[model samples]
Target chain A: MSDPAPQVPPQLAAYRATIDNLDAALIHLLAERFRCTRQVGRLKADLHLPPSDPAREEQQVARLRALAEEAGLDPVFAEKFFTFIVAEVIRHHEAIRDELSE
Target chain B: MSDPAPQVPPQLAAYRATIDNLDAALIHLLAERFRCTRQVGRLKADLHLPPSDPAREEQQVARLRALAEEAGLDPVFAEKFFTFIVAEVIRHHEAIRDELSE
Candidate 1:
């Protein structure tokens, strides 16, 4: 990586550093999230359960949207983000199910 | 929220609980991220700097993608997620700049 931008204002640089740290934390959190979901995927595969649960997903969307509002974030944006992550999880679940069946 | 699904396996329920907590944590983290970005936005406005920095954004995407690989997350997905958040931050920055100009 290149050296830090010396020309940037110190306060701005500090904020960017915090943002970068937060972003890294987010990636690690997402990795942990997938690890949990993978276990769930395995459990579902063992139980011969369906890969996707529409009802549960709907409930989670509503719950998260409320939480987003409480956190002063836009509920719609939160829902979109949650949905994106859930889609990835479901894809992994389906892959797991397929592998187990094969 | 509705009572826990009694029919769900305990293992599945536990995983779900962890997932729920992680999801909430993600929301809060995102909020904090925006909080930092907003500060940067205001600082940029105060300094009469531009709202968006394409070069810095490109650097961040590369940096985050590398970090994602280190964290075992899909680098492509991480880039997409980061791009989405940066887009929102830029929008907020633009709004802040507009407000200050007004």
Candidate 2:
């Protein structure tokens, strides 16, 4: 169950609004990323290539971890986040490969 | 434990690199959002105000779910994402409030 929402004063509403805006931007950004990655998945399927790439994944995780630290975010968390995303991308690629084969 | 990384072909390496770039952009955007939200927390503490706002939270969630739909993302997923972030933001606000008082 979710925690009870707080009772924010009128003056504080603007901050939450800003956060909402930011969240919207995040959604859009993620959509764009997926859109590009989807193309990669299709290309991989077209070439009869495998979905996963451990070396490239490792490189990306390391790069993102460093970048996260530079940006003052937890490297471990950033890596975990990317790991989750990479899994999803591969899943999509696998599905695309199957679809193209059939 | 994380799953073993895939062995991506050379052709796919470029795609992974693009994903990495997009992820970095996401991190930067998140950092910026938190920075703004932090200011709001401080202001709230200064005024001895509470952190959460149920009404605004609901409005934002509804707005985002719609935005997510327009962007081709899952509405339920978007709401959940905001709920998670809101929890974190409230936690931070609570901390700031305590620190200012102490």
> Which model scores highest in DockQ?
1
Kindly give the stretch of ten consecutive residues in candidate 1 chain B with the minimal lDDT sum. B1-10
**How much is the TM-score of the A chain of model 2?**
0.87
Cα lDDT tens digits, model 1, A6-30, are 4889898899899988988999999
Candidate 1: chain B TM-score equals: 0.88
> How far off is residue B92 in model 1, in Å?
1.3
Count clashing pairs, candidate 1: 0
- CA RMSD, predictions in order: 3.6, 6.4
Model 1 Cα shift for residue A79 (angstroms): 1.0
TM-score of 2: 0.75
Largest TM-score belongs to which candidate?
A: 1
Off by over 4 Å in 2: A1-11, B1-11
- Interface RMSD score of each model: 1.0, 1.8
